[model samples]
Target: MPPPGTFTILLFGPAQDRAGSGQVTVQARVECTCGELLRALGEQHPALAFALPAARLAVNHALVAPDHRPRPDDEIALIALVDGG
Candidate 1:
């Protein structure tokens, strides 16, 4: 389990591959918006920076806007964008 105010992010597809793991935990005691989390993830994993911008964010099993701020226990999933028709 993550600490208080921390959200667990489950990486998928290329995001997971880039992260080299299936999940990541982020701490947000002040204000942890989905966008901020993405940025933080990029900082933690440089490879993610390229994918974070194009990655789709889902919170708690629901697709959320970029500005959405997830709370503790919220499940965050980062889905990488795939190029092709």
Candidate 2:
């Protein structure tokens, strides 16, 4: 598990492809908002920078607004838009 003041984000679909992994650790305050997390994600994983705008952050299995502050126990996932017919 990541140390305190960091977030472990679960990646899915294209996000996983870009990051070359199923998860990533972002450094931020415990009170950081979802938007800040995304920013940290982009900074930490430059390959995923372009995809940030369209991606969504899920906390505790529910899609949350950018301003939402996630708790340590919250399940955080980065969902990229899946393209299919």
Candidate 3:
């Protein structure tokens, strides 16, 4: 089992395109904020950084505040909003 206070993040849609498919597990030492995680993900995937500023982040299937903190085993999903009416 993973160490205490650790969680896995799943990237989907444009976010997946940015962070790549598969799973990225982060340790507890890292701050579990949605925005900070997105920034780290963007760094890992430069394509994400290209347009990360406008991307939306979610935790546990719920839309969250910018400073939302993820709990252990929380599933984080990064979604890129499409602006096409």
Candidate number with greatest TM-score: 2
List candidate 2 segments past 4 Å from native: none
> What is the C-alpha local distance difference test score of candidate 1?
0.75
The whole-model C-alpha lDDT of candidate 3 against the native structure comes to 0.66
Look at candidate 1 and tell me the lDDT of residue 57: 76
Better of 1 and 2 by lDDT: 2
lDDT of each: 0.75, 0.87, 0.66
Clashes of each: 0, 0, 0
RMSD in angstroms, candidate 1? 2.2
Every model's TM-score:
0.78, 0.89, 0.66
lDDT of 1 by residue, 1-85 (tens): 6567666778777777877899876666637777887787777668777887677678777888878877766667887786567
Candidate with more favorable, higher lDDT: 2 or 3: 2
Residue 34, model 3: Cα distance from true site in angstroms: 1.5
Prediction 2 TM-score vs. true: 0.89
Can you give the lDDT of residue 15 in candidate 1?
72
Model 3: per-residue Cα lDDT over 19-83, one tens digit each: 56655655544456776667666665566566567776667788788788777567676666565
Q: For candidate 2, list the clashing residue pairs, or say none.
A: none
